[model samples]
Target: MPATFIRRIASPKKAVTGLAVAAATAGMALTAAPAHAATTSSAADAKAIAKQMIPDSAQYNAFSKIVQHESGWDVDATNPSSGAYGLVQALPGSKMASAGSDWKTNAKTQIEWGLNYMNDRYGSPAGAWDFWQANGWY
Candidate 1:
């Protein structure tokens, strides 16, 4: 007979606490707004904006896939677990403010920020999509 080894995982509370400690140590405060907070547009409107912003069909599709998985095109989407917010799920949602002041309620601003992030980090939306597909994130 073969014996199996068991692995243990940290509880969600412990994991979140550890993350909060790390963030605090780095001088960053983690915060998230309620998902229902002021939303200026619907998913359909955001999708339309994304299509216009990303004119290339292939690139747009790739970007769309990532957004669908991350926030389902919600302009004010918030990840209760990680505090990621907006259409791109920017870890500190405030990061999107670099794109525009309307980051919180504007789909266009979020998309712009997301596009820049994809371009800067992975070369293109398609590249980001490839990474997201392999890692379940981007």
Candidate 2:
């Protein structure tokens, strides 16, 4: 396998200095709510978006762990060296374009794309989790 693939398998959660940040500008539109409430971070938003997709607690837990390790729940988390992007660290990130056009801004898009990848590549989230545990990545 190529070194980038090996590195992804060995350290899939690699972090970079220039992570894209979700703008909180939308919160500015909330006239009644506190600015802080409107300022929900992408990490929290990603977790909420993920739970909506997984729904089941057991599956969500496993998925959550993998995503946490891979991204610290940051939808914008990226691997500078490998160029993997988003919550589950999809390499090239553009591959997620299959899931939706909003892949860059919407955590739901990334989550759905990631779930599809785990399903297609490893049979299921549990299977991906197992592979990640054994190999240090998924």
Candidate 3:
């Protein structure tokens, strides 16, 4: 099997990244309510976006763990070595173009691609979570 396919199939991190890409393709818009007129995103902000992309309640906890481990919820998180970027860490960061051109900084695109990947390969978040448990990298 191809490494990319295996990577997409096994990794929760990759699954979340796939969800972001799907969100971008679907043109998911994120709105912020200001606590004091300065728009800010909290953990809830990430969770809200995540819930929209991933509707399965069982998948939520597993997905959140991967996001926290990979990027700590920072939308602009980047890996210099592989050039992965965004909340879910898109490798080369540009493969997200499969979803949209805004893949670089748009959290939606990354999440979309990730969710699509998880659904396609493992069938559900629980399946992805099981794979993750067996493989540390996932």
How many clashes show up in model 1?
0
The global Cα lDDT (0 to 1) of model 3 is: 0.67
What's the best-to-worst order under TM-score? Answer: 1, 2, 3
lDDT scores of the candidates, listed in order: 0.88, 0.76, 0.67
lDDT of 1 by residue, 9-84 (tens): 3798776676677678778898975554344568988988899999999999999999999998887789999999
Ten-residue region with minimum lDDT total, candidate 1? 1-10
Which candidate, 1 or 2, would have the higher lDDT against the true structure?
1
Against the true structure, whose TM-score is highest? 1
Alpha-carbon shift of residue 107 in model 2 (angstroms)? 0.2
Residue ranges of candidate 1 with Cα displaced over 4 Å: 1-39
Look at candidate 3 and tell me the lDDT of residue 86: 66
Which structure among the candidates has the greatest lDDT?
1
Q: Model 3, clash count?
A: 23
